[model samples]
Target: MGEKDKAYVEIYDTTLRDGTQAEDVNLSVEDKIQVALKLDELGIDYIEGGWPGSNPKDVQFFREIRNYHLGWAKIAAFGSTHMAKYRAEEDPNLRALIEAQTPVITIFGKTWDVHVRDALRITLERNLELIRDSLAYLRPHAERLFYDAEHFFDGFKANSDYALATLKKAIEGGADCLVLCDTNGGTLPQEIAEIIKEVRSRLGKDISLGIHAHNDSDTAVANSLMAVSVGARHVQGTINGFGERCGNANLCSIIPGLVLKMGFKCKAGEPERLRRLTEVSRFVFEIANLPHNKYLPYVGRSAFAHKGGVHVSAVSRNPETYEHIRPELVGNSQRILISDLAGKSNVLYKARQFGISLSAEDPVVKEIVVRLKERENEGYQYEAAEASFELLMRRIVEGRKETFGFFDLISFRVLDVKRLEDERSLVEATVRLKVRGEEEHTAAVGNGPVNALDNAVRKALLAFYPELADMELEDYKVRVLAGEPGTAAKVRVLIQSKDGEDRWGTVGVSHDIIEASWQALVDAIIYKLLKSRRKRLEAA
Candidate 1:
């Protein structure tokens, strides 16, 4: 079937408005504009900029975003109904929505009687009038005006007649679409389906309907899908599910659920745009300065990572055996994790990934698996340290006995000098290594023992390998393993290194923290040297 022939649903993203309400999620005006541009590239139907009346940052965003042209999305300004003390036309909040000059305007109003009585502290009749007046005042200025019936599900349950009455007021006020919001996020999928059905029955199918859900109950995605099944044509959510409390519906999960699983269509569901989903998801997290949630469905690093031997074996033959859909469809790739759970199949699969062809029956593969499990039992984690694992496999495959062929560690020492009169401690490290069978000795001083050791080692290797100049230590992490040793427990060190073009991870474990760090650091240097040599060979 053609794209035009499928049932179409509108994807309205409020990441800038509602998503920023999340704790620890704060975006500048420029960040908001960049996110809107990204959403436009993803083919979103509407991008809620923010409440211009609420903050100067949002107002600045609405101004700056006007300078750029969006390919697909229409900009929306979000706000609440005007206060009861002022007429809608005379209200500053309503005026700000009009002044934003956006093609779309969304205003939310109290739907639950409890909110009207307790929150708004206004009569139910007055709240209804505010909903009607605010939307009506902004209707002509906006190309599209959407009404959000806040707490609609709870409102319907509290007073079905009043909740249904709120919809009537919005319709009378010239709303282009009425979005039913599960504000408290306590509604279930079954409840969403039943409530939407009842709304459709009473309000008829002529009026446009949308669903806005929160994830307090962890059912925002499911509730959004359920609302779609019950005739909601518009779906509202935020990227990565960011919001005030638990979060709004996650567009990352909802988009694929609607298109791939349910056979519905939207602009983002198009093949080309869908492939950018993972990139877009990571980009937002980067801009937010937050760590990406690796377990997020469809767009996470661990989403399709196979760890179990049996599962990896099955998926190697056919991805459908383990994956619900092809990872490439969402621009993500399958991953094979190596650990104690790894089998011969896992070893062969990883070898292939590293461009080393190996058969399932290879004795070297069996040896590698055995050694890997033994290392893991000793607190070594290869899942995040693939470079170290690859080096181990190469050594086993080649039948080499030395720890590393590039260099050999003879001995190293660190000393700290402190005085009672001085508040700071001076640290120094000395390293001796044989590079190409030639012994090289170096010494260096640094802020700490690890830094001094790293500097000394690099100084020692720089004379033999000029390419080591470009290599940098990106991140270092240490974890103490649980054991009966108390403060003397074994520690694992994971080091991340990058050489401008490529990055790799290596790990080492020992009872001494410095020794563990040195082991990882040595693995990192060896990996870099080997990678540079491979590239040079390939070029030749």
Candidate 2:
């Protein structure tokens, strides 16, 4: 059969079960449904919703999703094998799987003597019995049965005979699919390839195979690909590399490579599912309240971005000279970073990218670039805060100087309380400022303490530049200091604002999240108003 007609590869996502094991990740049923719908729309074959017996929330999640049409993907309920000595029919864990009402069920079986003898407190033969009985018991009830040989990689290396024996038992027990797990996340890619080759060579005719690798050694991606090359047809992972220890193999990198490069039919039938890769990669991080990845392959902020004089010059001539693929092919955009490593070509190219005109021979480009490096060396990363960088560009390259840019807020404070009516919470804030003409005092209230503080600062600056009303906070971020919980609080805030096509960021540091938010908010407003006047002057 041709590649397209070959037995189709299945994409099994464990974002709910495996992904939640990532540090500080918790998703409500609604969040799970939103992500599942996105995954289903992307055409994944299966979604391992969660281990239902582990929590009530997951049980409810299956109930909630069951009411909706699953489209191409079947929501699989995940659980472990029946308890060490209990019959599969009487085990509550097995019953929980039945109650989930999913068409598919995945149960993990112990593959390592270490886990069997110590963790499960069962004999090797008895452990294999659990694997056999669990699959046989559930196979009759479900449309599909998958057995995850948890820690199979390590189990194989530690005791090759037992590991292969476990796979044999599960296959004989009527598992529709058999999965080899790198559960401890300590297997090397070459080891994964060698063992997978052995498994493929010996059991090639007996069972269909899949892989579940982890990233503890940072080789999960490589190991996963190695398994695929060695005849594994199913790839099990989470979107955006979520899981325990380091993380699972990054399905973000795997699925695209499989479908687009290896010609595998992993996305059901819709090949266009490739385009949603970057967006869903970002969407998952957002729902989990995590920061965006800057260098994630095929989709990070810097994947296509170029810096350095030589690099930017060559990129301007032909993007393919530097870029592996057109960034749009993967839903990412190219950027030019301004840094101390940047050369004249880099400066000019970045200036042009922002619609600001500057020449290599122009003294202003060189002057501003040097001063910019100096500012960054002192703790201003305009890269992460492009809004701040644009304001600087408008001031110099475009000859847009501001006469009233001296509005400086010396301090600000915010206070809020929910102890109120069903109405919105009360927010109060005050600011002390020094304007070019004279110092000013202003106060304002908003729906929250951060918004109130932002209002107070912006209201104070509006006295000097009324255009501040046109500028607004587009985004805000607060990061607490490492190793310090709350005692001596330290916060960092990044604010993004836009006027027309120009956006800039300003950052602030304080002991209070509210104070830091106001500082960055004020910087963003000032930066936006300044850039607008600069662009007007450039046009003039």
Query: How many residue pairs clash (N, CA or C atoms closer than 3 angstroms) in each of the candidate models, in the order given?
Result: 0, 3
lDDT of 2 by residue, 39-131 (tens): 897788899999889999999899999767767899999999999769988899999998998999999999988999999988899998898
The top-ranked prediction according to TM-score is 2
> Per-residue lDDT of 1-540 in model 1, one digit per residue for the tens?
344347899999999999999998988775687678889989999999999999999889999999888899999999999999999989999999988999999999999999999998999899989999998888889999999999999999999999999999999999999999999999999999999999999999878999999999999999999999878999999999999999999999999999998889999999989877886887677557565698999998789889899998998788899999988788676777864333565577568878887897777777887897688679886655779888888888877644557788899999999986658898999999888989999999988888899999989989888899999887676777878477789988877688777667788899988999998988888889888899999999
Where does candidate 2 have its weakest 10-residue lDDT segment? Answer: 376-385
Give TM per candidate. 0.65, 0.66
Give the Cα lDDT of each candidate: 0.88, 0.77
Q: Model 1, poorest ten-residue lDDT window? A: 338-347
lDDT of predicted model 2: 0.77
Off by over 4 Å in 2: 1-7, 268-271, 338-540
Q: For model 1, which pairs clash?
A: none
Candidate 2's TM-score: 0.66
